[model samples]
Structures are given as structure tokens and as C-alpha cells.
Target: MTTIQVGLYFLLGAYILFSIFFCTLVLFSTFADSVFIRYLSSTHLGKPVVYHLQQVVEWLEGPKCGICLAQYWSTGDMAPRVMNCGHTYCGSCIEIFAEQKDGMVICPFCTRTHFCNTIHPLPFFSENHLLIILCSSLITVNLWKCQTCRKKYSSQDVSRTPRVYSTCGHTSCEACVESDFTQKKRVVCLTCEGRSGGITVVAENWKPHVPINYAIRDLLKE
Candidate 1:
């Protein structure tokens, strides 16, 4: 083809590809945003625990404050705000529990500080409640999120503590990383790369699984 024709064809192809990509991006963005709004717009947690007693089966009959064991019967309408530890307390009481006497919110009973302050959806649901909501939402609606990988779950659940963590926030279960990759296949913690500290696969069991936890302790001992 002549140079002008070739250039025209290339331009047409580029325009078609660009239009397709733009349309796809717009649709995906709308769907994602709609889902997020619906998730947050929900008052699922505020729906008054019709099955609150189901949570602490033993405490069902004796629904008492998880922090002080103060009976719910003692406190009026200000219902118990349950923490993930399978414990419950008066909302105001837990507010006290979540307060910062020295600018730090520490759990009075378990001493798990600022645990309630993290951004999981608990303005209404606890861990158990969120699990129930997620399952039910999946059945009725197209709600989707992975707790470990999703941003919402991290803010809402505070997350599972990793066996290995990086400064950039890359984390993994020690056993998981150890078993997955082959030798010389570097699994750099995505967040911790170029930062300073992170778990490097020093050895493996199939080839000498030396967990970094052990390595750190040894280095300290040395």
C-alpha cells in the first residue's frame, strides 16, 4: 500500500481500539462504583440483631457487657456493640473502651488497643455479622469482595496478622510463601521492595525451610 493509505489504516485501527478500550473502562467503572455505593448505603448492621443472641450462645441468656460483664438488662436501649472477640458491651460502654486516655484507644478487658477504630464496616456489623451479610448478599445480589485482598475488608476487619510483613505492607503467611515458589524464584513482598525490611526466603524445607522469624531471632542472638 502507498504511505498515505498505510497511515490512514493505522489511524483507523488506533481509533477503533481506543474507542473499545474507553467504552470498556467506562462500563467497568460504573459497575464497580455502583456496587461500592450499594455496599456502603446499606444499613445492614443497623438492622437490630434479630439474632444477636445467636452470637454468644452461652451469653444468650446472660447477655452481659463483654468488658465489665455488666448485664444488658441493666442498660436501657443503648444496645451492646460486639467486638470480634465474641464479646459484647454497651455502645457507650464500648465507646469508653475505645477511647484514648492518653490519645490511644485500648480495649479495657483484652488490652487490644484501637482494635475497634479500624475501618471495617462495623459502624454496623461485627466479624460474624459481616460474614453473614456477605453470604446473604452473595445469594440475593451480585456483591463480591475478597477479605484478604480487598481494600474494604482491610479497613473493616483490621485483617489477619501475617507471619511475615513488610514496611510497604506486603505480607504473607510464612508457610504459604515457603511452599509456593521454587528455588531462585524470588517472592519479594510487593510493598516492602526497596524499602528496607521484609521476609526473604532464606531457605526452604523441601530445600531447608528456614522461616524468617527464626532467621531474625538467630541474627539477634548472634
Candidate 2:
């Protein structure tokens, strides 16, 4: 081969090798621990954060509170509470919903009645501890943003808005429900385009009249 042709061939081979090396470095950096740490640090939750693949799945597919139509907090006063019919709701919202039902609480989703009478005459609700841990893990990484509006679920504001999921496992906020109801006369799922029949006012005194998706929440816990 001519000298110039040989030189061109060598340059092309070097360029291909350099391109491969650059692509490999990019892929490595994408999954590097430092990159994970940068995301963790940006959340401002704390130090020594550990990443888990299962937690990521839970955070992406976790259930939202049917009442108030916001994501479940799963900690402190906002911890999730289960009804006799297997529906779940934010602890505080459930209390407000059941406050006027004597000692009986009704499942808004299934319409099944459950008794929450404390043997010592104290008030209480059934809590899902595993779900709470999953939620807390998501919060630590700041992945609590609602998939619908892309708005972050604020842990500092414990009383922030509520969330509800459709039968198709899609979530929507109380404000969206209200807006759509006023315009369409029914609550619509922004994700699946499913319609919630007969839901006139979902957010009444910060409580939604819809039922929670306990099944999805349980699955995440598992």
C-alpha cells in the first residue's frame, strides 16, 4: 500500500479504539457509586445512603392514598392504614373519615365495614410497617415525586395533598380530580384514561371519597 494510504488506515483504527474507550467510560460512569452518591446527596436526607434495586421498583410503583389523592407518606402521622376490606389510606385521613362512624370504619373502596374499637378505649388504626419502610427509603432518595404531575411529595410537609390510584394502577391528585369533575362530571385517570364514576367531590375537607388500592401497596411490600 502507498505510505499515505497506510497512515490513513492507522488513523482510522486509532479513532475506532478511542471511540470504544469513550463509550465504555460513559457506561461505567452512568452506574458508578459516585453518581449514586451525588443523587443521594442532592436529596439532603442524610449520609451513608444505600441504594437498593427493590426500593427503586417500589418507589416507581408504590400506591398512593385514595383520600386527598396524593402519594402515601408511610411514616409518622402519614403512615398508611388498612381497612377490613384491604383498602389502605393515610393514617390521618382515615381517622378523619372514620371519626363520625361511631366505633366502625367503612372501607371507601369496597364499602365493607370494619370495627376499630380499642380494648382500652383508645383510638387506633391498622398500620402497614413494611410499606412505611419502603416509602421512607424512597423519600431518602427524593424519588417521591408524583409520576403524574412530576411534583415532589414533600416529607417535611406531612400534611401535603393526598393521592389516589385508578383500577389500572395509575395515580392522580385531588386537584386534578376536582378540575376534571367540574369540567367532565366524572373523575378521570390521567395515566390510563379510565373514568371514576359518580365521584362528584373527591376532596372534601382534605379527604377523598374514593377507595385506596390496597392490592398494589401489598404487592410492593412483598
Candidate 3:
């Protein structure tokens, strides 16, 4: 065969290989995304609970706050809070809304007004425990893996505390972080390095301590 013919054949073979790899990557990504979406939907619809309980939970937690349009967190000020009208909003937004209207919090969706004393009196709203549980479950399902060791976080294993690096924001179990630091004498983000083709230096905050990821820890507790 001519050299030109051989070169053309090689080019065709390379293109075929690239196309297969690209298609496989796309398929895998789609599958992962679909799984995540289905889990999210199940949480929203309260599929794991009894029919009656599901209805009640769904009514209490409607995914996001209408005022701020942000998804509820498991804890802290951004956590879901329920008013007297049974409508839920993030704790921060609800407090702001209540204060804006002179201690009368109006539900933006239903236009129902709830009065808060704002002084030494009955609290206007309460934390939505059911919604907090749901949010924590979602977070646990999605982010339970330790980036370094690739081990899953379990409530049974109270020893494993996930720690987030200050610079890279990647999380790994406390054991892995300590081991890595001991071996290398410095903390670096392996995941970031693998992806970006260079060493990504995490802040030297490991000298004194690496802060535990309270958000992940809180979810794992549930």
C-alpha cells in the first residue's frame, strides 16, 4: 500500500478511537446526573416515608424559600423555618421579612400574615426538623466520599471526621489528612493536582490544626 494510504488509515483509526472515548464519557456523565436527579426528586416527594407522612412532609418543605429562592440548608440561619401559617422559608429570610413589616411576617406565596413579638415573647417561627433531615440526607448521599481515601462516611464510624482544605476546598477524612501530612510533611490537594496537571498547595493551616467540616459532620450525624 502507498504511504499516503497508510497515513489516511491511521487518521481514520485515531478518529474512531476518540469518538468512542467521547461517547463513553458523555454516557457516564448522563448516568451520574440522572441518578442524582432521581435521588433529589425522591427526597422532595418524600418517597421513603409513609403515604400520609409523605404528604405532610412535602407540604412542610417545598424545596426552596419563595422569598430568597434559595434551597434550605441542614442547619444554621439558612435552614428551613416554619411560620404559623405553615409556610416555610429560610430562617434568615423569614426573620428579615418579619422585621421589615414591623414584626408581621407575611407569606409571599399565600399572603398570610404571622405576628411575632420580636421582644420577650413566643418565637414566631420554629425550625423545620423534617426538612432539615431531608436536606441532611441529600447532602450525605451526594457528598459522603473522602476525596483522598475514597472511603464512604458512615454514621457508625464516628472516628472519621471530614476536613475541608482551606485553599482547594476539597474534603478528606481526618485520618487521611493526618497520614498525608505525616508522610509528605505538607498538605496538598491530590484531586486538584490530578485534574490540573500540577501540585495544588493547600494552606499550611495543618501546622496547628485542620478544621473539621461541620456541615458534613452535621449531616453524617443524621
How well is each residue in 1-222 modelled by candidate 2, as lDDT tens digits? 999999999999999998986674554445545776567655746343333433443355455676776667756666676543446678667666556676666777777776765332123444543346556564432344444666544424332233443233333444554565567655555555654321233443323343343433234221
Q: What ranking of all candidate models by lDDT puts the best one first?
A: 3, 2, 1
Whole-model Cα lDDT of every candidate shown, in order? 0.37, 0.51, 0.57
In model 2, the clashing pairs are 68-162, 69-162, 69-163, 70-162, 70-163
State the TM-score for model 2.
0.35
Candidate 3 lDDT over 145-179, as tens digits, reads 77567787654564466564433334567778777
RMSD of each: 19.0, 13.7, 15.9
Model 2 residue runs over 4 Å out of place are 1-62, 117-123, 139-222
Deviating ranges (above 4 Å) for candidate 3: 1-69, 72-143, 154-159, 194-209
Using all chains and alpha carbons, the TM-scores for the candidates as numbered come to 0.24, 0.35, 0.35
lDDT accuracy of residue 42 in candidate 2: 59
Backbone clashes for every candidate come to 8, 5, 0
The better-scoring model by lDDT among 1 and 2 is 2
Model 3 — TM-score against the truth? Answer: 0.35
Candidate number of the best lDDT: 3
